[model samples]
Target: MSDSLERDALKEILTASIKEQRAARRWGIFFKVLTFGYLGLVMALMLGWIGAHESESASSGPHVGVVDLSGPIAADGDASSQLVIAGLKAAFEDKNTKAVILRANSPGGSPVQSGMMYDEIKRLKAKHSNTPFYVVVEDVCASGCYYAAVAGEKIFADKASIVGSIGVLMDGFGFTGAMDKLGVERRLITAGANKGFLDPFSPQSEEQKQKATAMLQEVHQQFINVVKEGRGKRLAADNPDLFSGLVWSGESGLKLGLVDALGSVDSVARDVVKVDNIVDFTPQPSYADRLARQLGVAAATTLGAKLEWQLR
Candidate 1:
C-alpha cells in the first residue's frame, strides 16, 4: 500500500509540473502579442500625425524651392553638386513654385563640382523659361560659390555679407624634409618623366614648379570664362584683382558688380520675389535616422566598455 501511495504521489507531481509549464508558455505568447500590438498602434499614430502635418504644409501657396549651398562643393559635402542639382530639379518640377532660390554661404570648394552645378542650373532655367532663378548669398560666397552665383538671373546679398572669390586652387604638402629626418626613402616609379612632378616626399624641381603654375593658370582661365558667361555685362572687369582669389564684403561686392542687390532672406522673399511664403528644399536627416545614429553610438560605447573591462 505504501509503494502504491508513493507511485501515486510521483504521478501527481509530474502532472502538476506539466500543467505549470503549459500555462507559462501561454502567458509568454500573450505577452509577445501584446508587445507587437502596442508597437503597431504607436507606428500607426505616428504615421497619421505625419500625414496630417504634411497636408497642412501643402496648403501654403507659391512653393519656393530653397537650395542650401552651405559648405564645400564636393560629392560628399553638404553643398554637393548632386544635392544642389536634386533641389533645383525639385524646384523646377513643383507646379506651384514661381521662383527658385540658391541660398549660398560658402568659401567654395571643388572647381569641377561647382562648374557642373552652374551648368545644370543654367540648363534648368532654360528649360523652364517662365520661372525665375535667384541667388541669395548668406555669408561668404567665394570662388566656386561665386561661379555658381553668376548663373542666377539676379544675385542678392546681405549688407554685411562677404562675397567674390573668383579663382582656382590646388593644394598639397611637401614632405621631403620630414621623410629625410625619419631616414625614409621614397620609392616612386613612373613611366613618364614628368608624372611625379607633385610627389610630396620628392624634391621639387624648377621644371615641376613651372608646370604646376601653368596648369593652375589654365584652370584660372576656365574659371574666368565661366564667370564671364554667367555674369554677361554685369561684371566690372576694370580691376584685374577681382579674379585674384580675393574676397569682398557685400557693400564692396556691389561696387565690383559681383552682386545685383543687397538684402536679407526676408527682403528677397518679400520684395524681390514678391512672395511671403518660402519653402526649404534642402534635404534634412529624418528623426528615425537620428535615433538610429544615437542607438548605434550607445551600442558602440557599451561594447567598448565591456572590452576595456575584459582587457583590464
Candidate 2:
C-alpha cells in the first residue's frame, strides 16, 4: 500500500509540473508578441503614419491654414504637386479657414512639377476666391520653387532669405577621356540618328550642342514669361539679371521686386491672414507610402545596372 501511494504522488507531481511549463510558455509568447507590436506602432508613429491624419483641423473659428512646401519639388519627391494640391484643396474647402499660407523653403527642382502646382494653385484660387493665398519664404526659394511661389497673391520672406533662380538646366558629365585611359572602347548602337545625341561616352557633336542650347533657351524663355506674368508690374525692370538664373537676398529681392515684402510665417499668418492661429495642412506621407517608395528605389537601382550598357 505504501509503495502504491508513493507512485500516485510522483505521477501527480509530474503532471502538475508539465501543466506549469505549458502555462509559462504561453504567457512568454504572449508578452513577446505584445512587445514586438508595441515597437512597430512606435516606429510607425515616428515615421509619420499618425501625422498624416492631423493635417486638417476641425475648427469652428477663423484660422490660417498653412501648407509646407519644403525640399525638392518632383513627381516622386516629398514636395510632389499632387500632395500640395490635395492640401491646398483641403485648406480652401475648410469652412473655418480665413486664408491659406504656402510656406516654402527649397533650392527648387523639376520644372514640370512646379508648373503643375502653379496651375493647380491658380485653379484653386479661382474656385475659392474668398480664401486669400500668400507665400512665405524661408532660407531659399529658387528656380522651380519660385515659379510656384509667384502663383500666390503676395510673397513674403526674411531679409537674409535667398530667392529667385528663374531658369532651366540639363546637366551631365563626359567620361570619354577616362574610358580612353582605361582602354575601354564604347560600342553604341542606335536606330535613330539623334537617339544618342547627348551620350557622354561618345564624341560631342556641334549640331547636337546647338540643338540642346536652343531647347534650353526656349525653356528659359518660358520661365521668364511665367515670372513676368506672375509678378506683373511689381518686378524691377531696371535689373537686367532679374530672370537671368541669378539669386539674391530677400532684402535685395525686395529692392529688385523679386519679393513683395520682408516677413515670416508668423507675421504673415497674423497680419495678412488676420489670424494668430496657424494650422498646418501639408500632406504627410504614410509609413506604407514611404515603404513603397523605398521598394521602388530598390527596384530602380536593380534596373539601373541593366541600363548601364546604354551609357555608350
Highest-lDDT candidate: 2
In model 2, the runs with Cα more than 4 Å from the true position are 32-51, 293-312
Candidate 1 residue runs with Cα over 4 Å from true position: 1-60, 284-312
Q: What digit string (tens of lDDT, one per residue) describes model 1 on residues 233-291?
A: 78887888888878888988888888998986668878877887888777543345334
Candidate 2 overall lDDT versus native: 0.82
lDDT of 1 at 52: 28
- Cα shift from native, residue 156, model 2 (Å): 0.3
Model 2 earns a TM-score of: 0.89
* Count of backbone collisions in candidate 1: 1
